[model samples]
Target chain A: MILTVTLNTALDITYRVRSLRPHTSHRVSEVTERPGGKGVNVARVLAALGHEVTVTGFTGGATGRVVQERLASVPGVVDALVPITCATRRTIAVVDDRSGDTTQLNEPGPTVTPAEWSAFQEAYEALLPTASAVALCGSLPPGVPVGAYAGLVRTARSAGIPVLLDTSGEPLRRGVAARPDLIKPNTDELAELTGSHDPVRATQDARRRGAGAVVASLGREGLLAATRDGRWRATPPAPVHGNPTGAGDSAVAGLLSGLIEHLPWPDRLTRATALSAATVAAPVAGEFDQGAYEELLGQVVVSGEASAA
Target chain B: MILTVTLNTALDITYRVRSLRPHTSHRVSEVTERPGGKGVNVARVLAALGHEVTVTGFTGGATGRVVQERLASVPGVVDALVPITCATRRTIAVVDDRSGDTTQLNEPGPTVTPAEWSAFQEAYEALLPTASAVALCGSLPPGVPVGAYAGLVRTARSAGIPVLLDTSGEPLRRGVAARPDLIKPNTDELAELTGSHDPVRATQDARRRGAGAVVASLGREGLLAATRDGRWRATPPAPVHGNPTGAGDSAVAGLLSGLIEHLPWPDRLTRATALSAATVAAPVAGEFDQGAYEELLGQVVVSGEASAA
Candidate 1:
């Protein structure tokens, strides 16, 4: 079973209004909610791909209950979320019907108490033993130590479980230094971490910083990976134009799933690139188009050289 | 007990962001939730004024649960909300810290099924016998008949309970014809109802259309009323300005409480005017400043003539 950790889980809500205007009241014509966080999104995609996945995170209060209830309905995904006292945060995406633009309002996640953090670490360790691969994803909620992912990555390494760290800023920098099996950082995140805009240099610099492998998601351009086995650039056959939300999580899901399946580096890149493109093309956010994924999987172009070492 | 009916109850959420720009992501720094709807707001103010208040409405789903839970925490307020299958709506007031302006996003209330509507009417009828006065407030949720408030007004009257109707549009129009004991319309609602921007003419016109009495809330100018006892204009000693969000509801609470207390028309007007001004002076959106209310109560100027009869 693949394990995904979302320390700062969210109940994502989308509201559709005829048009958005500042300081005026709007009547939202539609509302949609989904259990979300980077890891949760990755878990959902993994489950959809027929992988047995367990999701662990801090969930509490009414919003958390809604998230858990919705997560329960998704097949092949198990909820192992740690209970906390504060209500989980909510992220609202207000979509304007007129221009198809979205204004986002995000509430800060519940602050994790020290005891809750300790309890989460214990729960995560308990799940690690049976997990084939683990993905540590998203931002750290307040009150959790700054080096949270770094410590988690070290634990997974000690347990001999492959882990993929997908986060940004301090967490990612610290997690990378813990030498996770893989890290998938989008272009902005990669640039932030390595202080370089050059994709190849940043990806390689991330690996040298202790990531076993680095896959940088360059939206539309696709994935660039530097790994122990090889370096590869994978791109979708044609540019897919749609909502890019959750595309990165799909890439992470693809990479983790391919790793568990023991796919070669180039094949993993192909799957990751195709899945990311498919997610962008999906009518609904956080879901991949199965037909697009299958077709693009065969069409993704992969070019790279095997590592000389 | 004073009974307040919010057919379209809501979980009112306030998000404080540094700034709110359209189509841009905002990180809300603070969040506050309150049980809201015009009736709910009235009930809270009545409860704060030491009146035993019973709140009944259709509540369902997670957001409804949150509303109910918060209502339960209010000291003198009783939650008698009827259950439904659909979730209650949420109204988000995004407060921009930089500019102190608020953008409101209101979700359309749950579509009340016929069965649920019937159930609510039954619950409302049961509560009416014990209620000294009933207040029908806010818009009718979808699926409720347009004449819902009219039917409810007639029911309360039949039970010998005076009903105060506080709503706008067709609901208010239909409810007025049912001869509710009192109808409070703001300047805009009055204009819409009577086709007259002149508050005195509109208020009198509203009364002739069937309201036992008409009270027009004229923002900073104060309250103008045409009642069986007299015609009066009540104004605060001076303009009280702050957040006027719930000032109208506070006025409704004051009028209802004074009516049940058997206060004279002039005294009722004074109380209503003071409470409205105090609500505006309060730091919080829906609460009235007790000190301000007490201070303003004595200072409110009421000038009127007793009806010739």
Candidate 2:
């Protein structure tokens, strides 16, 4: 079973309005809510791929209760969440139907107290022993140390579990030093991490900084990888156009699932690329188009020096 | 004691964003939640005035729990809310700090099941015996008959309790037929009810349609009342400016309080007008500035043939 950690989870809500005018009132035509965060999305995608995944995160207050209730509905995913005093944050995405534009409002996640942080650490240690691989994802909530992921990475490594760290900014910088097995940074996050516009150079720089492997999502350009065993560039069969919100999480699920299956680097890249594209084609984030996935799996081109050999 | 009915109560949420742009994202700087609805606001103001107010309506789910918890904090107010199977709705007010503009997104309230509607009716009947007056406020949720308020009004009248109806559209048209002791309609609602934009003419017409008294809120022009006792026009000393969202609810509370106090029509009009102005000056809806209320109360002028006395 793969374990995914979301330190800052959210009750993701979407409101549909005819149009969003700055100072006007709207009778929202529709409302929707779902459990959200990078790791939650990854766990959901992994579950869809028939992987048994356990999700651990901090949840509190009324919003947290709703998130837990939603998580209960998803099959093959286990909730191992820690309780906190503060309510889980909510992320509102107001969709303007006329303009097809989305206006997002993200609340800062609950502040983690010292006791709560300690509790989470204890919980993480308990969950690590049974995990084949662990993915530490999303932002560190308030009161959590910047190097919190580093400690978790070290624990996972000690347990002989392959760890994947996906985050941005200072947390990524500090977590990299702990040497996670894999790091998935999108184009912007890659630029922020390495300070280089060139993807190939940035991937190599990230690997040198302590990441055992670097898989960089180039948005529509597809996936670039630099690993000790092999390096590969995987491209989608066609340019997929849709909401790209959770594409990266789906890619992480693909890579993790492939890793557990012992697939070759080229085959893993193909699966990851197809999954990313299929997620974009699906109506909502964290859900993939099974038909699209099946069609694109054999079509994705994984061409690199290692794959050629 | 005043009983305020909010059949479609809401958890009012406000999100403060720096600026709201179409298709963009915002990190909300702040989030505030309060129990809200037309009747809930009325009850809060009545409670502030030292009146024992019992609030009844549908509340369900986690949001409803928060609403009840918040209602507990308001002194002299009782929560007699009915429970439904579905969750209560949320109304979001996104305030753009840069432009000082507010964008509203209201979710449709819970769908009331047949059993839930019967339960609410039973609770409403049980509370009417203790209420000096009843105010049926806000819109009816889905599955509720358009004549729901009309039935409630008849019940209050049979119990010898003065009932105030403050709703709009078809509900208003149907509710007025029950001969409620009072009906408060804003400019647009009055126009929709009587098909006349002229406040004086519309108020008289609304009274003719079976409303015992018709009080029309004419925005900054103040209030126009055509009652069985006499006709009166009450205005604040000067036009007040601020958020006018809950000014009408405050007016309803004032009128109900005056009715129980056995104040004459002119005095009631003066009190209601002053309260409305005070509410506009308050930072939030349903709350009034005590100083402003005192000053405006003495200054509000009531003029009509009856005021000449």
Candidate 3:
């Protein structure tokens, strides 16, 4: 089973309105909610692909209870979230029916106390031994140390488990230094970390900063990987467009599952690229279009240079 | 004890952002939550005014639990909300910190099953006997009968209780015909019910439609009352500048309290006018500034002509 960590989990809520106007009242036509965070999303995709996954994070308050209840209904996923005092935060995506644009409003996550953080660390360590691989994901809630992910990465590595880190800002900067097996950052996060707009350069630069490998997700374009085996660029057959909300997380799931199965770098990239495209075509986030994934799987074009070293 | 019925209760959540821009992501700077709906707001104000108020409505799911928990913390308000199979609705008010403007997003109320509606009716009827006055408020949730409030008003009247109807649209249309002792309509509601924008004319017209008396709440201009004893206009000392989210509910609270106290029409209008102004001066909904209420109470001027008949 794979272990996923989301330190700052959220109850993602989507509301659809005819139009979004400032300082005006809107009647939300539809409302949908699910457990969300980078890790939770990855876990869902992995579970959908027949992988057994355990999710660990902070779950508290009424929102947290609802998140746990929803998670229980999903097959092949286990809940290991530690309890906290404060309620989990909610991220609202207000979708305008007219323009098909989404306005996002995110509440700051619950502040994890020092004791609660310690409890989570213990719980995470306890789960690492049985885990084939681990994914450290999302932001650090207030009160958790900024370098918290770095320590978690080290713990997973010390247990001889391959770990993937997916986050941004100072946490990513610090976590990379702890030498996680892999780090996935989208274009914006990649640019912020490596100060390079060019994807290839940023991916390579990120690897040089102690990440075992770097995969940069470029929206619509696809994935760029820089690893010990080689450098590769994988693109889908054609641009699949819809809601691209959880596409990156799908990519992360693809890469993690491939690593555990010992797929080659190119094959992994192909899977990741296809899964992302399928997720983009899905109506809801944290889900992939199975038919689209199957069709795109054989069509993903992977091109790169073999390592000279 | 005063009984208030809100067929469509809500968990009102307010998010404060630096500024509101459509199709963009915002980090909410502050968040606050409370039990809400027109009657809940009225009950809160009445309770604050030292009245023991009983609130009966439909409550279900996690949001409903949160609403009930919050209600239990309030001093003089009792929750008699009936359990339902579906969740209560949520109303989001996104307040822009910069411009002090609010953007509202309201989720439609949960559909009450026929059994749930019957349960609520039984609960409301059971509570009406001990009530000094009853206030029926807010929109009807889906699945509830359109003439639900009318039935409730008739039942209360049969019990010899003075009932105030404070809703609009077809519910108000049906409820007024039941001959509620009083109906409070704002300018828009009055216009919609009477097809006349003139407040005095519309108020008189509403009375002819079977409302025993009519009070039109005019924002900033205060309250205009057309009652059996006389016709009067009640004006606050000055315009209070603040959020007017629950001003109408506060006014309803004041009128119900005054009616039970057997105040004259002019005095009832004065109390309602002062409470409405005080609610506008409050920082949060369902609350009034006690200092403002006290100061404005004595300062509210009521002038009118006596009934010649």
DockQ of every predicted complex: 0.92, 0.84, 0.91
User: Isolated chain A: TM-score per model?
Assistant: 0.99, 0.98, 0.98
lDDT of 2 by residue, A32-102 (tens): 99999999999999999999999998999999999999999999999999999999999988888887678
Candidate 1 ranges beyond 4 A from true positions: none
Residue pairs in candidate 2 whose N, alpha carbon or C atoms collide under 3 angstroms: none
Q: Which structure among the candidates has the greatest DockQ?
A: 1
State the TM-score of the second chain for every model: 0.99, 0.97, 0.98
True contacts kept of 3: 0.89
- Name the candidate, 2 or 3, with the larger lDDT value: 3
Per-residue CA lDDT of model 2 for B16-104, tens digit only, reads: 89988878888888899999999999999999889999999999999999999999999999999999988999998888888767888
Task: Give the per-residue lDDT of model 1 (tens digit) for B115-137.
Answer: 99999988998888899999999
lDDT of 1 by residue, A1-309 (tens): 999999999999999999999999999999999999999999999999999999998999999999999999999999999999999999999988998888999999899999999999999999999999999999999999989999999999999999999999999999999999999999999999999999999999998999999999999998999999989999899899988889999999999999999999999999999999999999888899999999998999999999787
Best first by lDDT, ranked: 1, 3, 2
lDDT of 3 by residue, B61-158 (tens): 98999999999999999999999989999999999998999999999899998988888888887898899999999999999999998999999999
TM-score of each: 0.98, 0.98, 0.98
Model 2 regions more than 4 Å off: A307-309, B307-309
